[model samples]
Target: MMRQRILVVDDEPQIQRFLRPALDAAGFDVETAATAAEAKRLAATRAPDLIVLDLGLPDGDGKTVIETVRAFSSVPIIVLSARDQEIEKIAALDLGADDYVEKPFGIGELLARIRVALRHAEPAGPLPGPEAFGPVVLDRDRRTVTRDDRLIHLTPKEYDLFVLLADNAGRVVTHGTALQRLWGPAHKDDAQYLRVLVGQLRAKLGGEAASLIINEAGVGYRLVTS
Candidate 1:
């Protein structure tokens, strides 16, 4: 099989130097861009399988790169930034990034996230049956959730929230995206509403199964399928 191509967009030479060989060693075909303009050009023409982007670009903010790329492609884009502010993360994610990795990050963690993004980008196959996370099983066709063969009831909003997380299992679902999907664009910044819905859903899932919903502080939630 051909190695998956990763477009690394960062203005810092050291970051390029650090990630090029690392991503190559990790079995990816790596390409680098040092400015937002070049990043957008390469993204449009190169057909990279994934993109590792830095928010601080010499020509423009990385978020614009995300917005531009997202306009035409669903290829996974993972933000690699030094900015740790919650707003920065939310903006990147809401703009269509698949994942965000803070600067001074571990190579192992970054690699793991890259793998998850690649996996998520792959074409999904038909589900054989109800999707299970730990002891909780969600039967989307039947619109029911069950834990250990016992029925677990959920309100409409709670069910929608769970479905969103479950569909994006193993990846962070940003607060903005979740709220907008569940409550429309007007409530996109209403993280508290998401929190309450999550709590209610977790309570219904109950016991060890409740742990399936993993919280990414200041970011969003991830559903642990395994």
Candidate 2:
């Protein structure tokens, strides 16, 4: 089997030393870059399956590097950083990172996150049963969604969220879990977006049918079943 490639970009030599052996042992082809510039160059050539980045880089901040790479790539990125601020994490996730770990993280947890990030990134066919509830109806296989027998417009993110939830309808999807899976680990605390999104979804489907996607207090949201 071909080894999965993982890019590790950090200014700290210690990070490369600690992460390389661990990743190699896990059967990944490890590539190391000491600066953001090098990371970008390596990413362009190697197209690594995942990236481990430190927020503080020698050439530039990790945010810039992330933006640079994300301009064209949807590659999974896990940010390793010393900063533990909630806003920082949310910003990174919102910008398109796959996950994040605070400094002094466990190798085991990092490995676990990598597996999850990759698992969720895998291609998925549309779910079965023709996604529908109340006024919304989506034929996954046909790539069609309708409201009251008329097509409804959806932005990519909105459609992504709808498909994810519709795929597992009538089940409770925790806010933290959904945000992490869809947006990234950094967005675990951005529950406010959930409310905003749900409201918009309700509006798009018409106010009368808004209850199809129910909110679970103190936990998360779920599709209304009963």
> In terms of TM-score, which candidate is strongest?
1
Cα misplacement distance, residue 81 of candidate 1 (Å) = 0.9
TM-scores, all candidates, are: 0.91, 0.61
Task: Output the lDDT of residue 96, model 1.
Answer: 93
| Per-residue alpha-carbon lDDT of candidate 1 for residues 1-226, written as tens digits (9 for 90 to 100) | 9999999999999999999999999999999999999999999999999999999998889999999999999999999999999989988988899888898999999998999888888897776379888898899889899999999888888888888998788889998889989999999888889998899888888889889999999999999868
Instruction: Report lDDT (CA) for all predictions.
Output: 0.91, 0.78
lDDT of 1 at 166: 81
By summed lDDT, the worst window of 10 consecutive residues in model 1 runs over: 124-133
Model 2 misplaced stretches (Cα beyond 4 Å): 126-226
In candidate 1, stretches whose alpha carbon ends up further than 4 angstroms from where it belongs are 124-128
Model 2: per-residue lDDT, tens digit, 1-226? 8888999999889889999999999989899998889988988889999999898887888887789899878888989999887667656755767667889999998997787677656787555567567778878776667888898787766777777667545444566767877788899889888778777777777766677787755555656433
Best by lDDT: 1
RMSD of every candidate to native, in Å, equals 1.8, 9.2
